[model samples]
Target: MITIPFSFIPPKILERLSKHFLNWGAFLEKLFPFLQQELGKANIKISAKQYLAMSFIATFFLFLFLGFCLTIIFIESGKVLGGIFIALFLSLFVFFMQSNYPKILANRRIKKLDADLLGALRAIMIQLNSGVPLFETLVITSKQDFGELSKEIKIAVDEISGGVPQIDALERMALRNPSPYFRRALWQIINAMKEGSLINKVIENIIINLNKEQIVQIEKYGSQLSPVAMFYMMAAVIMPALGIIFLVVIVSFIELDEIVVKGIFWGLLGFVMFIQFIFMGIIKSKRPSLLEE
Candidate 1:
């Protein structure tokens, strides 16, 4: 195996470190060799200490928030036992959810990386066609001097060096990424290798197909977003505006001194607020994470 120059070591380590923070659960696959067999990347790159620190920091702060919220509820509602019970349940819920949050996001990110895996391989084929040796092509391109594409390639190269078979290494990457498109492309690459055939044309074909797939994805996202934006605008602006108009009409035409009129207005306002919350949830669910792209 070629040794990485001392000059490149710091940046490489730093990049690996930051990558764990960006996707912690996925990092676990790389941390344990046994886990690597079931995962995408096999690097043992991130120290166990890092995730330990993460878990500690997260639990400490979450408990504090839970305590504070419980205190507030106890003071206002005068139900200490009930508040404590609810708070305990909520604290556990938040702890697990918050602890898993980074991993969930990382899983999605890994999947996207997998989706982009075939593209990276195609780039490698291009580099090879231009006479760059496989190892150097991997080393240079994996360094991410070319962007995130390099980072993933670098990890794949690491797996190869770590004595993992090429097919397993590719499979690990596919497992980690969990993108069906990426898996399809990777399986094709593996098949080409098994047949000992030229990959240049196949690589080009895969690139074209990936581009088309991405365009279709963009269009689909666009369709989802357009309706969401319209809904938000209608719920946030149109509904509120209509509510205000109704309020004015009631004030001008009806003697709202009766309790029933006031009750109706309050009921309408509450219903509107409930609808707003439901719409907000829909918007949140529809929007993709900022990290995916």
Candidate 2:
């Protein structure tokens, strides 16, 4: 579970402001229908309206801060209009980014769950094969250090302990979790339990399927990495270096002012850094989540 970062305002003040904008937030929630489910998947306990309201508040503060700083810079350069435009653009960017933050956290949780799922399932299978009851197996799995998977199992265990039927608890877990593989495994277990089949046999089949899926993911990732690496090298390394040299030559031939040359170099540096950052993110995002650490 992640807490939304809005340190610019006190939590109490932010909460108050968010409540004041609840109607607007409700309208925005209707525009982005999936937000409520994403909040659950991300383990954020707040309602969609509350979260969206806070996002708007944070974005509003960000815009004010940027406007202040950029106004000073643009005032010196006699470009106040340009500063306003840039600040508006940045504020909107931040709002959209905040809107997707729950989904990002959900994806992160899915990756953590996927990374530890196989080991956790194997532990469960072993315990069951040793004649441990399903509920006890789940409790033991929940106590183990299986990262996010352990935490999710703990939730189900808690639900069962609180008088929920095992099948119903497991079904709720499957429905709320963002990982397809985890949900599929849970559904299979629920089905096996319903049919009075051997739980160990169902778990074994799930392990085999997961292993095959992991292998396919690895193969696809390998095929993707070659081209992605090539693109990264061209875009982030060779192009930046060559472009800098070309720009330097042009500036020299044109007898550009020293300040202008410095500004151009700084802009190119920023552009190169941006390209490198984007390529790094792409490479990390392409990594197969199921790979063993």
Candidate 3:
């Protein structure tokens, strides 16, 4: 393996730190299972142990870098207590980022899967109604260009071909997937198989419900965009422009120190960028997962 600068802490050390020293098992028991499940759904090949190790290592390095920068800034500025506060804040930020990385990946995967779900499900229903067996329908779907859903169904097809029963394989896939809609469809298919109900009709009903859900989501998103766009405009554009103009006007009237005036200008710029990032996150969070484009 290629050695990196941060490789001083061996993987074993990180693993042991995660397992015994931190007692992560006790505190993380609730969240780690879902993390593992998300890893599977996201098609990430790393184990939860490996994922945790990587996250810790990355977090440590990130904090290390931030600490160095803050130390220099605080020492030059002669603010020892502020340095400590900044270090604590960075630690908390690292903790949050480490804890949520897997969830972020899983959410991305779920979005991609949902984006293509309607088309995939419609194709499956068509194949089933045409008298194709469930296994063949999945295989055929897997051969298509449905993105993550296709890749996931391909995994199910591989499992079924490897001697796992179709229903069991489908159930396993559904259990590991992050989307409730995906799981509900799989459960209905499983039930249809058990009860000898029409799989085609079950899938058709799912299609209709999913379509209704998409329509509702579109309406909600449209309603949501107005306020978000207004906030973005005020915080990121209008506020910054007004602040810079006010600062310039004040500078023209008073003899402020060059350092203080520069600091205000740069600080305002950073705040504007920060607000833009917050609005970007809000937009991402509000976006419906089922949107394909």
Candidate 4:
């Protein structure tokens, strides 16, 4: 039995949905030994390239765990029907949790990068505008540890020193950000530089756009605060309590038959759960689209 009934407060159910889409969360455990004997047997690139190896590790663990769960359910439970249901539920939950892991990390990095951007841009603009060589300026920015943006820019500089083309490095950084703006900006920078294009004013213009984006986000969330609060109160608190109370009143005061009371209780409980799902989906929609997975 669920410790807490489906309600608007927690998001576990939706998380389970994501796990269904990202099967790695349910596939990893079964593959670990082979992965260990193969990928682990080979020495590999360690840093940014580690994500691929990490993904394999995650996949291996997930499948093994899920298979273990199934093995237990089938052999130990005896009741195949209940065991199958439980196994399915657990598999879905794991997938949902894993699918959202990157989303959670990405969300945090995006927020941190947003906060760090203004400072980094201001610093970069000052350096570039003051006749500081772009390479040295990037090195300086990388050295400061301004946050995610700094770390990424520094990595691009490292790639440059390693003889990687500057444009390709920048493009890869843009891919990691999942941002079109970064790609477009870096592309323009690359083209202009090769053509002896003057880009100081262009950097300033990009800075302004970035600043505007932050401001627009602030205003959007600020505007949403009141309505979101109202929604929380109505969905999480008011509705569930009212439902339980209605069941209580019918059970105690109303001269209804016992069957009628039980039926009403079950009906109210189901309806409350349905309402919870609706409200949860609504609240989720109001959050960033990238978080929807």
Candidate 5:
């Protein structure tokens, strides 16, 4: 039921394949809960089964187009086996990317939510302390500019307006949100309300705990970065520089062929680029999931 952008496969054909293909449905069933929870946080409306079907259709068409072009090129170049192998590899890669796209988007949303959470909680605490009703505080926060936090609050408010109890709406958000900090805050709020405790005080405690957690994460990241920094220096800086120097000295002494020299240069460059890519991923993974002050 999902319409892919610029899709070459007709909707009817994709729909038939998705419905008749029992294995795809079963495979998607296994992924539905995790995918559904993530998609809920990101506010995407499509079901997991629909997303899986769309990914399958998209992968099939993409593979067909790429395989045709590659086959033609390989036939012309007299490398048919090479082309088929590369086409299959690339097609599988695309399928993996397509299948995981939703999870990737959800992770991005979770990061943003974590980054904006402290501000959102501060706003809620302020509103609640000023004697505003809990629902009113949520509504006010939803209208403000708190990024993904605001959007999720608005969703909860909408659910409340649609006759869901306020606590139930908030609890639903807690259960589905990807960020642990946001979930903990919502659960604390729910607990406070249920026990008739001071809401503002509960929020304050949650903020304090979240700040402590963030500080710990930051310290851990610093410790992790020490080893990574050493590796980066060795792999990206020292090794490349020494390798280039050694290659230059060898070329002067050995009179290597031009093709061999070019190949060596390209190989070294590719290795440096690969190291840089890996280092960037490590840094990103190490980034603390906390809202800035």
Candidate 6:
């Protein structure tokens, strides 16, 4: 379900081309069998074959477009082969990134679910303690604003309303969800139900365990931050400044052309910016979902 708002080709044309590439898509599915499960976890409502076909078609067009632009630039410098090679490399990189997009999205959903899960579970426990039926508690939870957790619960609520057994609905939700904690909680609830144990006690135990896990996550994040901060300072700040100063001294001794000097400085600036961007992403990725601001 990828959409390009300002694409060079029409959607209809892309769809047509994608259909023709279905065989290639099937081949890709064979090579990376996990894509099917990832697509389900990401909630992307398309068969893996169709998705891979679309991805291949889009990437193919992207390669052609980049190849053309780079060819034009390199033609001016009589380096067409270099342009082709660079374009091929970039195209392959984009294709691999596209292939991993589903897993990335699934992980994001998992984080959002984990961030809200404790509160949602506590809400359910309170409702149950007040004598609300399990189905009613689920229905109420589905109506609340617990982000992705609420949406997932709503799916179970709908399934239960449609004559599916409550346990079966919960099982389905747990199976498809990417959040391990959510699945564990659901399985615990299912066990409690089957054993006819007090659901409140089970929920309370789950909340306590989740709280302990969050504490560990916070401590782990704190332990990681110091080293990451040091690395960021070295790579993005001190190194760049020192490197620029050293480059200036070297350039003063060398008789480089003005354009070449400017190019070198610009390239260094780009590299520093890239380093800063990478470090920032690493820090953000290391942040615990429950601690997300």
For this target, which candidate reaches the highest TM-score against the unseen true structure? 6
Q: What does candidate 1's lDDT look like per residue over 57-97, in tens digits?
A: 44445556666778787877777667667766765665455
Residue 282 error, candidate 5, Å: 2.1
Q: Kindly report which residue stretches of model 6 are placed more than 4 angstroms away from their true locations once superposed.
A: 4-13
Q: What is the TM-score of each candidate against the true structure?
A: 0.58, 0.92, 0.80, 0.57, 0.85, 0.92
- Residue range 161-244, candidate 3, lDDT tens digits: 999999899999988777888888899999999899989999999999999999999999999999989988998999899998
Q: Model 2 off-target regions past 4 Å?
A: 1-7, 76-78
Which one wins on lDDT?
Answer: 2
Residue 272 alpha-carbon offset, candidate 3, angstroms: 2.8
- Clashes within 3 Å, all models in order: 2, 0, 0, 14, 0, 0
For candidate 2, write residues 57-81 as lDDT tens digits: 8888988888998999999889998
Kindly list the per-residue Cα lDDT of model 5 for residues 1-293, writing each as its tens digit. 34544347776677666765556755865856676665565566866676677666767787778788888998977998788788778877876666666777777788889989998888889988899998999999999988888988999999999999988999988987788889988898899989999999999999999889889999999999999999999999999899999999998899999999999889989999999999999899679979462
Cα lDDT computed for each candidate against the true fold: 0.59, 0.89, 0.79, 0.59, 0.82, 0.86
Model 4, position 262: C-alpha lDDT score: 80
Name the weakest run of 10 consecutive residues (lDDT summed) in model 1. 1-10
Angstrom error of the Cα, residue 42, model 6: value is 0.7
Name the lDDT value of residue 13 in candidate 5: 74
lDDT of 6: 0.86
Which ranges in model 5 have alpha carbons more than 4 Å from their true place? 1-42
Worst 10 residues of 4 by lDDT: 40-49
Best-to-worst ranking by TM-score: 6, 2, 5, 3, 1, 4
Relative to the true structure, candidate 6 reaches a TM of: 0.92
